[model samples]
Target: MDPTIRNAKLQDIEFVLSGIREIFKIENDIFVYSEKKKLARNAIRDKHIRVAMRGDKPIGFSWFKIGDLTPFGLDYGKWSRKYCWISFVYVLKNYRNKGIGSLLYEDIMRICKRKKVKQIMLDVFTVNKKSARFHERIGFKPLLSIFTMRAR
Candidate 1:
């Protein structure tokens, strides 16, 4: 059976946190679970999350936010007033490559169209080639590159 996508609720906090933890593990990044929990709470309250459910269990989710481009010092009002930033899209390890992620992305695209968003952006770690390729396959092109270094 195919999973259905729906907006996440406060009750889904634990599942969202678990997915974020899994992402951190894959990227070898450090994080404070409490902080992530707070962010997830806010995202849910703002209706910025879409969860893919199989029966009663959440198998994947996508989190995103829409904002005006002018705030970033890009004063191209004629070009685009709003943009979307996809923060995360995660599927359970056991259920990957099964098109759940694509379904989650399609849900976001529908929302963006309804909201008149001009562009969508997302970040993928350079080490995560699989994710980058997936995004590419979904028609996301690289606009810029961000690099980070640890200051010793």
Candidate 2:
């Protein structure tokens, strides 16, 4: 079945937050929950988040914003005044390879194109081979690598 892509609503807060937590696999501290809640709430309220529903349940979602390049985004291999930054995208584990993720990604691309965005950017950890492969299949190129050094 085709998925219904639409702006997220307040009711989607839990689903959105859970997606973030699961994808990031970060510690579920009170501060983390609060921050996720705030961000999810704001994104939905601003209509910056989209949800793909298959028969009334959300199969996946994507949150995006237009802005200057960041470490988490591609550099387009050239200068651009602005870019479409995809903050997060998540597909339910059971929904893998069902085309739902592509639909959501395509919708985001359409929006960015309509807005004349020069490039679309997002990032996945180097260890996430699955995500990297999926992105490559969808036409994303690596612009840079992010490294972390602990100052102990």
Candidate 3:
């Protein structure tokens, strides 16, 4: 089905948040509602939240922000006045492999371009191979791996 892509409405807050929590649970066996809720609420309220739906059901979503210029986005240093960062892009498991994620990403890209954003950045978990591949395919290059050292 051709997915419907548009800006998320205030009414979509709960539904979008629920969808993100559900998707995150697939990877995180022990999901924390508090953390996810905070992140979801922030993303949903941001003007950049893009929602993709199959009828009334939200199948995918992406959150983005325009700020300082970075390398992983369009026009490196050209629009130093503005930059964009994609915080979250989630698609339901059942909808994986479809073009929905790409669609949402493209929408974010369009927004960035319109805003004259010079670059964009996002961090994908090292373990999420699918997400890594998707970002790479979408023209994002890995710069560094974020790590934490625990003294045990």
Candidate 4:
């Protein structure tokens, strides 16, 4: 539990993107996907992005933005207050199952509270059972089903 969690800065963009890439490679195997650089440069560039670091090395990261839309796992009509949308959350494979994800989640929730947000929302792929469990454990219950119809 020696990891330090803090708000990321512009100088930390590369490190954050690199850490996310590592997570994607291990968890999703989407080696060619990387829009974090542009996303980082766009809106979140001014907002806060939190990163977890063990000594000088980063092991996980989470980015959020304030919004009104309820993500896939939330009932938007039930709650009308503004929400905090977690854009991206990832932990390095080597650091998984070590409580780092929970730590980061708590930290982000604290931030949300400080910001006076009414709720926190996020989306996980319907097929990722592991991820769904993680979110459930953290008290994010499923609220909506997204159906995509493929053209034959």
For each candidate, how many residue pairs have backbone atoms clashing (under 3 Å)? Answer: 0, 0, 1, 0
lDDT for model 4 comes to 0.77
Please provide, for model 4 over 86-151, each residue's C-alpha lDDT reduced to its tens digit, 9 standing for 90 to 100. Answer: 867878878898899899999988888888997887777766677789999989988667787779
Question: Which residue runs does candidate 2 get wrong by more than 4 Å?
Answer: 26-31, 69-80, 149-152
| Tens digits of per-residue lDDT for model 1, 27-57 | 8899689999999999999999989999999
lDDT of each structure? 0.88, 0.83, 0.75, 0.77
lDDT of 2: 0.83
Top candidate (lDDT): 1
Winner on TM-score (3 vs 4): 4
Alpha-carbon error at 36 in model 4, in Å? 3.0
lDDT of 4 at 74: 55
**What is the TM-score of each predicted model, taking all chains together?**
0.88, 0.86, 0.78, 0.80
Q: For residues 1-152, what per-residue lDDT tens digits would candidate 3 score against the true structure?
A: 68988887777777667766765664464667788667766766766688898998888888777777554654433455665777678887799887888888788877878887667787777667888899999899995675867799
Off by over 4 Å in 1: 69-80, 149-152
On lDDT, who's better, 1 or 2?
1
Query: After best superposition, candidate 4 residue 98: deviation in angstroms?
Result: 0.7
